[model samples]
Target: MNTDTIVAVATPAGKGGVAVVRLSGSEALAVAMGHLTASRLQPRKATFCRFTDTAGQLVDEVLATWFPAPHSYTGEEMVEISCHGSPYVQQEVVAELIASGARLAEPGEFTLRAFANGKLDLSQAEAVADLIDSATPAQHRLAVSQLRGGYANELKRLRQQLLDLTSLLELELDFSQEDVEFADRCTMLDTVAQLQSRVQSLLGSFSTGNALKQGVPVAILGRANAGKSTLLNALLGDDRAIVSPIAGTTRDTIEETMTIDGITFRFIDTAGLSQSDDELEALGFARSIKAAQQATILLFVRSVTIPFNAYATDDIAYFTDQCDMSSKHLFIVHNKCDLPHESNPPGHIVSAKEGLGIDSLKASMVAAMRKDASANDGVLLTNLRHRSALQRVQEALLHVAEGLGQQMPTDLVAVDLRDAIYHLGTITGDVTNDELLGNIFSRFCVGK
Candidate 1:
């Protein structure tokens, strides 16, 4: 545990109704009391008081609460002061605390301390940042679940199972010459297979879980003046993108996010792809093609004004072929449906100008996401770090399985099993280094 006390303004900067300044560590209570005019500070109880500077000049009236070591946020002595939310007042209070020996906290230092004090595991510590940064309801729910031991609990169980197997394999090596097999070879193979399946399943859910945590990317593609921007404006119910009758008006991709049915979609309206002589427009066209390929869903917009034959060009064919529609959602949309049209085709027809079929388009997008998202499953693996670790676990188990199939030496099998166990321990933080902890916690806000 760190011996030096830390202080920072807990709330956002600027004037508001109230601001909270927090201190944590060995001398947190003493530092807070230095500026507070109160006879006694009680633990977990709010006490009204006056805050004063070193010269004995009153700074502001405030409420102070104290939490002693082993019970506070950092599992150390802590103090929180709430006062009028003026930038000047907050700064003055923090400055006074610094003079009283509390140092300003580094970004994420508070939460880092919490992790060191055994208040949370590495995965749970990362979730604290996720919960703070969540922009949508779905994200909030996912983060909350993670913070409340969502995948961490599962990871612990899985790690223990692997540890047990490694122990048995290592024990078998002790009686190698005697040929006394404590662990049955056939049953051991079966148990390893089951654990491998579970690890693979979690790895498979990474794409969908990550998309939910970070908004899903949807690329909008079409030719010049094909109503791509118009469709974007209509879907967002605002003039978010520039729409014009002129061709090649949108020379670059314009991205925006909107939540529908609690699912957030990042719509990237790329420059219209067509034969363009302009250098900038041509570069943008290349970007459009790349964006379409990477998107989770491709929204292909076509103005009814353009004949169907126009979409049959080589560029369109190349784009469609490059996109794996089987794995990705593809929405073929016919825009400007307000005009008279022919018989209904398989694709959705919409009038961006009149907002026709926009609702159904949104509904389709949500339905596609819902089909992919695992809602009620035990835990979704959202973090790429966890996914990579699981992948390593899978690779090591594969080696172990191969060795078992070949009837390899017991020591060789034990080596692979220990490798698998080491990788699994990294996920729940049973095995970690300072560098990994620093990288994860550095993204958090100061005074977390």
Candidate 2:
């Protein structure tokens, strides 16, 4: 939006088949024309030319593409030079671009300008990052839907609906003394109910989406020789954790990440939970307790051989006492499925050594991951900030429902509805602060 020329290397920094150096602004064509050693060129057309340095020395032979103003990205003239993959060529081309007229762009500066020029909205701009960082098929689908305007469409419709309800409430406030009705009570109730349901549904996707982006953290916890570490290595299909007949062989927590059915899981293998007189073992017990508190799911492991914790009352007292029932999901895993199934955990039975029943364990993990959000939906809320803001909006809408059902003053109901609408708008940056805007835009790499 500043109208000054911007330049950046659009391609990755390292060696590639070819590298792209990009420029955007009113002077973009002029800068490109001079560097490409051409007198003139057509817009949106690719031109083969020689790129030169300021001293008029030939740097590289490359292809340049120009896109003219108002119809291009950033709503301005844009040009890109495809040069040799050599780092020297890329650097020289970018240097000449800055020397000729363009300024080096900040991280995400190109996309920020495009947003300012109305080339893309806030949500669409955000999708650019999501698309870049996407690792799985589901993540790609969400980003593409958002980039294609699916989320923006839904949010816009919800905002307009809130506006209509508020307009009626305002009208009723104006006619308060005469006892004339502008907003029908029944109609308002139906609208509020419908909106509350939609917002809450959308809110549901955050937990699943975020967990998909960051591997779901599950902790394996149990007392000595309960086969917790053995289960971990078997689940990961590797000897990631040490196994032995000796009790307390694992003195520290070990972690490994893997993707199952496109969902990443971080398995934290904890030390044997035992009241040991050994100083090091005692320290390990402390670390396991810390991890247990932070874990998303607690795998209370037991062996078919041991069948139960030997020191359960003394060693596994944390689960029985300060366990967060709601925050942490619990999964009881019975290890040593290689032998005849024995009486053990009430939930799941598996052998980490043979990978027996591991598929069921993964299924159970994914089901627990979906507890807060449905991954089957088309649109999802992945950002935590948006979730928190939307939660506030949801609470305000509840207040609105309370006010309307109690036959409260029209002005009071209008205020609550307006507050809810404002919070919802904040999620999409329709109502946002400069600091938050800075944080959001700062994540982008230049030349988007």
Candidate 3:
């Protein structure tokens, strides 16, 4: 396709070590040559140049590099101008390119063009955004692996197997009138089972993948003056929430996502749980209960010296009387071991003020979530879009298999199989719509 040339400030704006202006499309080299004064240009080779306007106005001295089509990042003729990192210089360069017929690129338009030109598959393209937005080291590592063909290779192999099975079945259909047996029924059944198992394994990964992508929600719950806020600051290694000796200090939930040993955790500091008849305080307590329910893990903070409360000791009665039993994913934490206060006897002893037991608590939390991650290992259904698409494909495949087992008309089975194939193709852009593409790529940052 003869796409129009596009240009943009490829490097981050403002003063830096170096600024890069990228041009891609049919006229990339022409635009570069017109603006940049280079003695001779060689593919993949850097050249010293003096950029100038058409009116022979001096622009700036810079480094120019060109990459030919089918060998470039976007699989198009590409040029990169490395100039001094100054906003004025960058703006001047972009203006010169725009004046020379290259249009300013939109957010992710470069990558979008790459996809349209068949330079990258849909999954690898998505991984580009994931790589940029990664919050933790582990996340960045995983995204990099996926982008470099870890996940893509796996999906490709599975899809190829499914395609081969479908091809064999379709071939068998050709001699249906002659009562010929081209493919064995046992083989077909075994293949279906294998694909189903693979899909299920991927489905199991959604929980951990989601948790890894979006940090796990953990709510801290305890009575007023129970050192809940203090505990939060200790765990975060910073004072995020205001701490005071007064009761009902925290009015609303304070949320922060922090990583401890590569695992990301979203700690929610709920209003101190207490017996308050005040309508607003009652509402805060109610919100705490709600958090306890929504949370995957609950940190029930209390003083180490004080005896257990009715809610903590009478576990069955607490479940029966106040909070939902299913909602309580309980972890009893004894905060303020160094202070003189009433609290449950040191279960997992801690003094948030002294930063004691913080490491053990973190280790315990990691162990619990690690158990969750390991239980459903290797089968990571990370993308919700992929999961839903696969689910629909699974249903269509089941319909085809059921129709085959019933010995229905071959046309019916064939139609179901084609529909399933189409559904599967959507994962890699074979069957996709503009709206879906737009909604996805729009979330990407402009410089991407």
Candidate 2 residue runs with Cα over 4 Å from true position: 38-40, 173-179, 275-297, 307-330, 340-347, 363-378
Worst lDDT 10-window in candidate 3: 315-324
Q: List TM-score per model, in order.
A: 0.88, 0.86, 0.85
How far does residue 192 in candidate 3 sit from its true spot (Å)? 2.5
- Model 1 spans with C-alpha error above 4 angstroms: 54-56, 223-225, 240-251, 272-282, 303-317, 324-327, 375-378
lDDT to native, each model: 0.86, 0.80, 0.77
lDDT of 2 by residue, 1-448 (tens): 3789999998888888899888888899888888777767777878888998888899999998888877787788889899999988888899888988899988787787777777877778888888998887656766777788556788788889999999898887788899988778888988999999988877876655666667677889987788888888888888888899788999999999988776778899988866568999999988888778767788888776763645443444666465665556778777776787546646788877778888898898877765443433556777777789889989999999999899888889999999988987876667777686678788877667
Number of the predicted model whose lDDT against the real structure is largest: 1
Backbone clash pairs for candidate 3 read 205-380, 306-342, 306-343
TM-score of 2: 0.86
lDDT, candidate 3, 1-448, per-residue tens? 3389989997776798789999998999998898877766899999998988779888788999999997888888899899988898898998999999998887777788788888777777887888888978657755775676446766776678778777776776787788776766666667776777776666666656676678877888877888889988999999999999899998788889899888899898888766767788888877877776667778888765556764555532332355544423467887777877564554577899999999999898888777665553333556778788888878877886687677776667668777777877777776778887887788776656
- Candidate order, TM-score descending: 1, 2, 3
| Best candidate (score: TM-score) | 1
What would the per-residue lDDT of candidate 1 be over residues 1-448, giving only the tens digit for each residue? 4669999988887899999999998899988998899988998999999999999999999999999889988888999999899999999999999999999998889888888888988888888999999989879877887888557777877888988888887788777788878888899899999999888878876767787888888998988888999999998999999988889989889999999989898999999976769999989988998888878888888877666665535545667887766547878888888887665457888899999999999999998877776542647888888888889999999999999888898899888988898888777677899888888888988878
- Tell me the TM-score of model 1: 0.88
Steric overlap count per candidate: 0, 2, 3
